[model samples]
Target chain A: AQSVTQPDARVTVSEGASLQLRCKYSYSGTPYLFWYVQYPRQGLQLLLKYYSGDPVVQGVNGFEAEFSKSNSSFHLRKASVHWSDSAVYFCVLSALTNSAGNKLTFGIGTRVLVRP
Target chain B: GPKVLQIPSHQIIDMGQMVTLNCDPVSNHLYFYWYKQILGQQMEFLVNFYNGKVMEKSKLFKDQFSVERPDGSYFTLKIQPTALEDSAVYFCASSLYGGTYAEQFFGPGTRLTVL
Candidate 1:
């Protein structure tokens, strides 16, 4: 079974500070990775996704992530986080096949608190 | 913005009662899914439906849990004999396409509390 691991459970940063939330996955073959953000009382929104080509992918609201195959990591980064960026971020991994069931396995999620 | 909507944002029910959660996916979406999240845990995939049938379901989808889209209009999750462990935020998500690497749009979620 494919699994994801987010080492940090919570992270805090001041407004306008750079932030990076770590994510690691364990899968044998090529993996489809994704980053999602959830605001309080809101649904989870897609931040970005990585299939194969580019190692670095940009997302909305100035969010981006780099896929490292050797490291088995796909970490989310933001140059400057605003107060509104404070939310729960999740890293998910899914198999890259049509017959693999297309189920996403999620990390425990890292809570980001941007203090102004 | 095109978004999914979940009805009864919060539902409080006693144990052994049956509860049905409704979800309206994106108007043009073709794939629908259900996910569950405990207060402080990761969102776990429960099931996925497409073409009027179940595609895949995780182990977390208990025997008491069932999903249906009778008329291809509203996606529903029904839980019979709700258990205390069932108390969590139930999220409904949909994707325009069900192929690999497609991003899913999620609903605001329904908080189910079984007392």
Candidate 2:
């Protein structure tokens, strides 16, 4: 069975400050990791995904994530955040198997608040 | 960018009432999926459909739940005998099937409140 864990439930950062949201996953095979963002009353939007190769992947809105296989972690980071960055971020892991139907196991999610 | 549209952005219903949520996926996408998220909870996968059949479903998908993509049109999730625990935001997503890489496009979501 595969699962994802997000350490922080909520995080607050001042505008223009750096941000990092932690995410860890438990999976046997090559894990396809992804980051998604959801604003209030809005659908989730994919930020970035990492399957293989480059451990660091860049995403929209100046977002990026680093995949560390040894640590079993993929943390999202942004050099500077804006008030618009206030939203819920989710880390998801998917196994590369035919039986799984590419179903994603998502972390509980971390709510980010950017205050001015 | 492609989009998935969900109808009835929010619905309030009494317990035990039957409710059907609708989703209009991207015009050419062949894969559709459903996910549920309660207040302050993770978004969990409920089911995935392709080629007019359910390819996968999670434990949360009970017998009372059904999914259909009849006439190759809109996809729908029908829950019979809704309970208080069923109150959550239901999201519909679509993706290109049999592709080299799959990226799902999610709908804004439908908030269902069962009182």
DockQ leader: 1
Q: Candidate 1 residues A1-116, lDDT tens each?
A: 78999999999999999999999999998899999999998888999999888899999999999999999999999999999999999999877544323678899999999999
Q: Write one digit per residue (lDDT tens) for candidate 2, span B4-57.
A: 899999999999999999999999988888999999888898998888789889
Candidate 2 off by > 4 Å? A97-101, B98-101
Docking class of 2: medium
Error of 2 at B113 (Å): 1.4
How many residue pairs clash (N, CA or C atoms closer than 3 angstroms) in each of the candidate models, in the order given? Answer: 0, 0
Cα deviation at B83, candidate 1, in Å, is 1.7
Per-residue error for A36 in candidate 2, Å, reads 0.5
| DockQ of each model vs. true complex | 0.58, 0.52
Residue B108's lDDT within candidate 1 is 91
Q: For each model, chain A TM-score?
A: 0.95, 0.96
Interface RMSD values for the candidates, listed in order? 2.2, 2.7
DockQ of 1: 0.58
